[model samples]
Target chain A: MNRTRFLDSSRLTSALFWLSLVGIVTGLYAAFIYAPNEKTMGVVYRIFYFHVPSAWVAFLSFLVVFVGGIMYLRTRERRWDTLALSSAEIGVVFCAIALITGSIWGKPAWGTWWTWEPRLTTTLVLWLIYAAYLMLRRMIEEESQRARVAAVFGIVGFVDVPIVFMSIRWWRTVHPIVFTIDEIRIAPSMLAALLIALVAFTLFYLYLLIQRISLENVGHELEALKQRVA
Target chain B: MDGVKKALWIVWKDVVCELRTKETLSSMFVFALLAIVIFNFAFQLRGDERVGLIAPGVLWVAFTFAGVLGLNRSFIKEKDHGCLEGLMLCPVDRSAIYAGKALGNLAFMLLMEAIALPMFAVFFNLPVLMPSLLLVILLGTVGFAGVGTLFSAISVNTKAREVMLPILFFPVLIPIVIAAVKSTAQIFDGVSFDQSMPWINLMLAFDVIFLVVSFLSFEYVVEG
Candidate 1:
């Protein structure tokens, strides 16, 4: 809570920016050069390079919601709310990318742009649920009220994500769950590329999260400034 | 002695006021009836094939929308007259206030469903008045009210409260709706209780989870 500690946190932002640059470069190289063309879908399957990683990060965002929400409710600190909001926003972005890239990948693989198969449908539902969370935050004027209610929602909303994910496995669905890691069917080079992509995307997510937290801090400061001026 | 009596007194005051005015009940009943009518026209519920598959969805949809109306009114009256703040100032447990409000909202919703169910059966020419189906309706209503009351308290404080309640309520209530509709359909198909137990269990789970969650979170929501 010290002012110096708070100000020094900005250094982490620069570190993330540099790390993300390296990740993007490595991800692009692996996707285009290193990974082999998938036999069934051909070139378009390469979209998994970005698509799968984005999906992983989206789920990670909700994990932040769980931890940050619990802390906010327990400590009654505004910082935790800021962290939750940042994570939710980043989660939404990654979810959007996942949907779009999945669609792009689907066109060649599934021969259609869209289908209500469990994977796609559940992802769509996850998107709307978090979007509703952000909307609920906007609908409340008081910061404390917004934080408390949204934290409660963040916790409850996260419980649904796993259910949504499992709905595909539980019920019959058309979307195929390809690339089971344990199956070991994919080529070694392709697997290597995917590992690199995963690392890169995770670093990218960290970078985005830091940027968002900084922006939120600035917005909070601006609000405080306005209050003082008023 | 006085605190318990005062809280009970507030509960009675709300019930009597609602009885005399009947604003919540009438609005919810008429809204539910209209929703059923709209569904009837929209789906053309004449044939047996269409009616069987769509009946459960139509019934629950009506319940959800009508329940939203009831939830919105439950707090608006208290907030309008500043009775909520007065209630908060009392020495009684805040959970009592949540319980009383939720129970009142549950009563209004059940009343609306009671009217809607018979009308739905008559309109669709479906026999939904069976005991098993009625039991499913009652259990589903508990899950709905348990969560709806908590979210209503939260949403009523928001800027666009009327719109906010459904958005917040629906996603969290998805499990309930799915379980309710599945079980109702199973009963309508003449399935035995053993066949329907899983969905029933799921509904019970949802009710317990939300009831506990809402009870614990109610204080944070109602706090100034």
Candidate 2:
């Protein structure tokens, strides 16, 4: 189904809301209780179980913003703009959570709260780009014009994300992150927990996205209704 | 072919206007100089090792911020002076206007860089005037202006535009900035052109990608 009919359904919306809630509670248990403590990094390493998933969702949200933007530019529909705006706002929040959790994990393991690592730098850049996208949207008063401008930006910003990641990856002077999460062999149980967390977060993003888009749609309808009354 | 001609004509128009006033160039040059000098003072680049360490970052910092100053002017003038409406009245494709503005911005940025590179050498007593370094600068500037002109157009219509341009521009330009700085540093370090190939290739790829993207999207940006 197209986004409007799909996201517009009250049944699907509530289902997503309740399902995501259950998934997240289960995910918290998977992250904290089911996953084993690591040998080198110990308890701090558990943050990755959530932190990595948050980053994944943030990236997914920006991709949605990109697709939504392109579709809006093509279709000239308010619904696509709503999708873009809602996704941009949520992406920034998840990006922030990932950065914060990463920092929290970094302090105990890496001995520094922040370092110019590629993933960290790329994520920060992503955050700043989307934050600017939101800022650009807020600053413009004209609705359709705002959509056009913001869509162009949304396309450009997403295109830049991989390049941003690559350039920083090449540019970093330090040795690769000392905590080689790669070298740690994931036991089957840990892998299952990680899988559960990823699925849960993905569900949560969809639920949040549908809710936010509905709220925006209501706001659009309210404005229309107000104009009709006047 | 006609599109290129139209774009070049727009470029010519911008050049003539810029040459008449000397407004954008003078400010860009001076700002770049101040940035270079300030960086020189901040880092105290006496040793070759230290200069190699910090020069790329400082040089790009100067160019990007100064380059942005020029970029901000590219569209703001058309916008503030009501020239944008005039341009829109012309029987031209929006991409032509985009190309014209992008090229015009590129020319001004190169001119400013041409001046600043020598001054950067003098302030820091470094070998800045190498052929390889110039290529890196050109690639970097093309990439910068390619995206910069598009974004400048986008920002001029917004409120507190001065604040918005940098905010919206830099984060997206981070990849280009990193590539430019790294390539420039490698060239300065007496590395072979072959050695800096990866960074050079990165800049080239960025230049190509964004130039095409900005070109395609320019229509939506200007059309109401």
Candidate 3:
């Protein structure tokens, strides 16, 4: 009975699937048409369409990990642990896109592929910390122990993101804090484009998160089935 | 009254055990001294260039690396003899255990810092023994030991205990380290306390926030 419940997909999940399709199409359309060419760096600024949203979604996924971690530790529920792991795995995917897209954007803008500027360096460190969080989980063998340890780490690791982001502002750094709504003046079209992209990316992220959770639930059901057969 | 007494007993027991063995302290001291020696040899501190610039970085690096050793050992001794489980089995409140361990770790770290500060003055010909700089060290140590105690508990249970502590620790500690280094540098430059107050405030805030979070979350990490 529990196994069947686990395998069953919900209506919310299907809704997210359609939402994600809308998001991807609107996101690309806005990026290519609505957003204006950059005055300083033409053509390449289009990368911001994908790059910024990927990072935003990556950060959102980690926040899920943090909340899920706290819930797991509080309730000692295996489902929360599964949610935390699924979110972390998807978060890594977005983080990878953020890193790669940022690098690709960097090549044209900064005239160099990489510099140990504060923002870039801290983002790299953020990547390493979560990578280590996943590695820590893999190294532990016992299921309960893995969940416990990983939950603790997930909480600790997510708390560091704000610190990493602020390090550039606290310590003097060369990375320009662009796109501050207060600081930079932008045309209406550009703002509209960004808003559309933000909405689309958010939908896409929700879609991915739901899909991953569904797949994880299926895996858990399969394991239970095998256990029953045994 | 009984719970308070029991907590004090735990704290005192840790202190006396350290006094007798002196293992954690001795290794931390020696490790700190060696770190300074390595920095001196590597950087080749010339005449006036030494005093202001090197003092803050050297003290922090020494404290950070030495703190790692001290933090790892903080739990190893408890786990070795199964005392941690015994403590958990006690009726005393769990937060008391965290407070006791944090205080004990703080004392050990301060002792090492106390010794290292004077030695740093002698070795580098810097005036790090100043009262203001000492205040920065005190504030910095509070933040370090607060978070270190928590991460140590979490890391000690992991597979790669030693490596896991730093990887988990250093990122969360960046703010504290930055504040410590900045405040120390300000003091070294003879800046007034007002100039360095913001960094001090940041350190205090971090210490309070993490201290509370760690205290609340510690039970989860230790539960078998």
Best candidate (score: lDDT): 2
Provide the lowest-lDDT 10-residue window in model 1 chain A. Answer: A1-10
Model 1 Cα displacement at B55 (Å)? Answer: 0.9
DockQ of 3: 0.47
Q: What would the per-residue lDDT of candidate 3 be over residues B114-222, giving only the tens digit for each residue?
A: 8888888887777765778788888889988988998888777777888888887887788888889888888877788897887877877777878887888777778
Q: Once superposed on the true structure, which residue ranges of model 3 sit more than 4 Å away at CA?
A: A1-15, A112-122, A173-185, A225-230
User: Model 3, A127-200: lDDT tens per residue?
Assistant: 77778778778767778888887887788778767765565456653345443323324568777777777788
Q: Rank the models by lDDT, top first.
A: 2, 1, 3
Q: For all candidates listed, what's the TM-score of chain B alone?
A: 0.94, 0.96, 0.95
Could you tell me every candidate's TM-score relative to the true structure?
0.91, 0.96, 0.89
lDDT of 1: 0.81
Q: Is candidate 1 or candidate 3 better by TM-score?
A: 1
Clashing pairs in 3: none
Clashes of each: 0, 0, 0
Candidate 2 docking: what grade? high
Model 2, span A19-102: residue lDDT tens = 888988988898899889877777778898889999999999999999989999999888889999999999999999999998
For model 3, state the Cα shift of residue B35 in Å.
1.8
> What is the C-alpha lDDT profile of model 1 across B21-133, one tens digit per residue?
99989999899989988987887878475687888898999999999999998888878988889989988777778887877777788888888888888887788768888
Query: Which of the predicted structures, 1 or 2, would earn the higher DockQ when compared with the native?
Result: 2
